[model samples]
Target: MAWFRNLSRFSTINVSRRHDPFLLSSFNCFSSNNINTNPTIEKPSVDPVQYSGLGPTKPHEKPRVVVLGSGWAGCRLMKGLDPEIYDIVCVSPRNHMVFTPLLASTCVGTLEFRSVAEPIARIQPAISREPGSYFFLSNCTGISADKHMVHCETVTEGEQALDPWSFTVSYDKLVIALGAQPTTFGIRGVKEHAIFLREVHHAQEIRRKLLLNLMLSDVPGISEEEKRRLLHCVVVGGGPTGVEFSGELSDFIMRDVRQRYAHVKDYVHVTLIEANEILSSFDVRLRNYATKQLTKSGVRLVRGTVKDVQDQNIILNDGSEVPYGLLVWSTGVGPSPLIHALDLPKAPGGGRIGVDEWLRVPSVQDIFSIGDCSGFVESTGRQTLPALAQVAEREGKYLAHLLNKIGKAGGGRANSGKDIDFGEPFVYKHLGSMASVGSYKALVDLRQSKETKGISLAGFISWFIWRSAYLTRVVSWRNRIYVAINWATTLVFGRDISRI
Candidate 1:
């Protein structure tokens, strides 16, 4: 994390560079209570109407655009926008945008840990390298609609303390793209027991725990039963994330754990419990293929829901219990604390902030929301979009174009929802889904494309596609090489099991 802290030194914070740096142990999610009500910040003096392209503007004038979170949506908007014209400020807890697909690989050591995380500061050299554009890592507490300011808190660990931890980020055009968090679904003990797979720290923690379990199994005082229990890994939720993590875990056990602890090879077990069929989101045929592939790779598939997660054991809905050393929770995402804290119009069930075609939060015209944090209401039957990286990425690109059009047109404040329509409605294309099973096999469900014409592929070919796609999908050149090298190393030497 030294490099991570170092990346922010070049950003436009006016604070002194003398203080010690530390990664906030896990993410510090700031609720309204944790944030100070008032903080000192630079408010924009330029006329909003002229800066927003509604009125005439001088050559030197710039709009204050504040984007929350450095996930796909926030980063994409920053990358595409001309930072020189707009004074951009990014606020988030994490300093990097994790490549989620390769996160599973990092857990089992197929890829290096650093390969999956690209520093947020490097996302856009144009803005990140600018004199005043800042990509600050802080917790977004609340939005003051009356004052047009975002309340933020910077919480850090270790001995050295930072000055003025709480502050305000004022924006002329605001973007609330703070992404979602792992949902326990109100299940008992899940937060207390299970490990989430949402961020880089989660993957690092998984690796640490897995290595510890392996080493503990080899201890002399441990009985065979204890060792067997130590090898029981349970994965909840059968989505692509869960399936991909399960596959990587199986590969780790079969290749590394088995060879290292041959005596307990038969005892090592990986169980995947899903309320519905595994890979239910995929086409039926692709789902079947995934099931077959997972079964062949020695992963136990359980068709049930997890009622409760107790220490060392998970109680299923049917009263069955499965003991586990590692419980990786891959259940679907829910609204983040920031999202829940918002007082805005939401869907009937009340999960995400409801956004119209222009991705504007209701009642707040200048404020826009995107990514998993915002629940999109599509034109077609009011269908809610899934919380995927692809969806967030697409939404980011569209918002950039929307804002740029308004800026070019010299628009001002929206009088009503009808006034904000600068271009065509936002459209989300179904790109397709893919999951990797162990032993060089994968399942891919592609929508109608020029090449595939809507095809479902499985086995080695799909696996190859999976690797190639993710290899190129890495956001940075350094990360891409790191992943490629890690993959090559994994192929020749197997996954690294060292805990530290």
Candidate 2:
């Protein structure tokens, strides 16, 4: 009855009675069945050839190339890639590419986490047919090299936490730029207790966990020893990440917590334990500078190997136990599971994939590997390029050039001369190393021959250089501005203690 009533609204009201005779005549003829039954065949419409939105590019256009990972290598490759030639697609688990150098700063509240993260979908050669063309395959599990498809499991935007959260994508040419992760070395308790500083999410989790520990230490019923343990932040590995985190943690204690929780200031401490002397990778001069600054900042530097990480303490190789509230492990990297799954040939010492000068896989000519995961040999010597943003960036650009060339040739010829041509063996020009020590001191290793030539920085000068270089290297103008604003705000009114 409701449906009929709703349909009743379609009654045709007569506006002009002058046309009533014609209507009545037509109705009468139909009632009398005087209509001739004819089989009328109607031709369907033939629309003229019209182009849709950026319709799959011209036939002679570049081949479909897909890049995996949005880290330093993948992002840079996409950035440098030519739009006209290759139909570019970037698939990664993370939607945003984190500028990992500044990740520690974000955790310690020196910078906003968002400032260090550049959305992968935002930066591309041009606004693609698909707005999210820099496709975020957040659930990527493995690669089907045989099928030339990325076996992914991704959730649509805003539905990540829900149960239905996995999808796959097909690709033509795939670039594996997936970087390395922190290696546990089969060490027990390392995986269970030690926090890592690999991504923006890790930084965020660490920040939240650190804040929680601080707040819980201030609880009324908690004992002083427990509070002490809670406030002691022990960092393993004296590399740039560990050193920077220690420095930032020290500053946080002295600057923010001391003024607010003066009683807890004495309890708060940061200790860095390294197998060897800190910053083992850096030049001795720079390492010494960093050590001196760290010591002066009241961070205890323990020179020995860590035997094990327990519930609330780190046991050193020398039979000494140091109680810690938070244990951060920034030790070293190993081959990612994805890379290892490929069963590619690896170097002896490190398990990084082996390649010749052009950056291609030894067996798989079309597939290219770069960043921390790739290992290339030179005519002069063998060197595994350290997993750094700089290295990844260069390799990515180089890969883009090779890919462009391959597309131009219409996939007729091999891009490089060697079976695994990793582009002239990727000689990493040591552009010096820098460590941010507490206060206004930062140790700068000026290995470069330019204006900053071999100068060690201390006080405000080193700090300025460190800030400027990192800010310059940050991905986008919007992100750089946000970081600058956060820095200015922190200087003016101190860090906001809000957590979400």
Candidate 3:
């Protein structure tokens, strides 16, 4: 009766006078003589639709911090941020942070994929629980610094058949930690044929391909040359990732493959192709030790430049061809296409997004950058920091503290932190390096630089130290436990060779 009385009042007041099509249609819907029964939706009028996005924050709401990545830098920043001071919004293609140092272990089944991946929610609970905080499974397409907004599009690249939609988010502060992509030196077919070891999925692909090659090589009618080619795994980088993967592959061939896939074990081989010396960042002695250990583990080390990459083989600069079943490209990382497209200033030498000593983008109001995507501007007279996980992690930690300090000073709003005294500039101190070279052998260099004299260790003791250090570095307790269990299982039962 109440609903009918209200409708009668509205109908009585304007039913006769109103000529609006929408209002007339509404009245017709309730007409007793000609009631509409169809539930099908009508098409909308032709008008340019506005993109839906998070608008500027109200005065009463907490300041929003938009982080444009989920790597070591962004995740660390989100973890340390004071959620009560600012709402967190993370935009990344992947929802988890890959423990990169241990990523190679996953490729050879020394560790499970899940063990190296810590979900974004697990790293920062506020993003999942807080009313204003959120995690977006998307890639940032562009940034509008003047408007304090970031443009992002959903990532629906896999099995899902949904179309990607674009959205924008306004932020009081924006942190760019998009990281970097693997360098291929403009070689042809590299992107189409070779896989890079930067993410968990990459490692998974390597594992799947390795197993597939092994099984295929064991086929009854295959020729000897074809079998050898199919079982040959070539790694194109001498850095930590490539070396470690080579070590893991050799270990797998010697231990697990020899016993389980005995028919193809003799044919399985690993070749590490490096343009220069492997582990060039470590001390000379340590590098020598790594080289020797890798060789002793049955990995063939090749010093040559890749001229071109083909589907089944690579052509060297010297007109030689190296056939391989699997190719991994880890020649180090450089700025991504998004970085190049950005109109912001870039650091010299590598074209990374430029930042001041305080990690703030100069001339920009509230934008900052870190991780492999950022570097110091030339004016700062500071050399760009190496693109290492520790460098990114520490930079993120420092920026979090700095932002929290600004928030406490009542400058958490966009364009309001101009006069705040940012206490200290970010100074990077090299914390040493560690790498595992199979057969219970490793290298640990504690020097601040190649010239600096400090503790450097090699052998099984170093391997033990490497394991203990990275085990503690795994993002969450759950993953740490997973990694430890995986390692133990591997040591007891050997590396898992299941293709799936």
Best by TM-score: 3
Model 1 TM-score, all chains together: 0.85
Global local distance difference test of model 3: 0.87
Q: State each model's CA lDDT, in order.
A: 0.75, 0.70, 0.87
lDDT of 2 by residue, 1-500 (tens): 21112112212211111223342332223322223243242221222231011122234544566777888998899887777765676666676789888888888788988999898656784524532234644545776555555655444346433222223444446678888889877777998988999998888888887888888988899998999899888898888889999988888878898887776778888889888878766666777778888888889988888887898877888889999888889988888777777756675467777776767666664677888888874432567777777888988988888777666556612233334332344455757777788786787776653344465555568888999999899989999999999999988888766667
After superposing candidate 3, which stretches have Cα over 4 Å from the reference? 1-42
Runs with alpha carbons beyond 4 Å of true place in candidate 2: 1-62, 125-134, 155-170, 377-381, 412-427, 448-455
Q: In lDDT terms, how accurate is model 1? A: 0.75
Model 2, total clashes: 12
- Writing each residue's lDDT as its tens digit, candidate 1 over 1-500 gives 33234233332222212222222211111221122234342221222121000121224556667889898888888777766456667877887888888788888889887998988768877555565466666788888766677777665666754532445666677888888888888999999889999888899998898888878887788888888788888899999999999999888888888897776678788899999888776777888888888888899999998998899889998999899999999988888777877887675454788788778876675788999888754432456678889989999999888877776555422222244446787888878888998889998888633344578889899999989998888888998888888889988998887889
* Per-prediction TM-score to the true structure, in the order listed: 0.85, 0.81, 0.92
**Per-model root-mean-square deviation over C-alphas:** 7.8, 13.4, 8.0
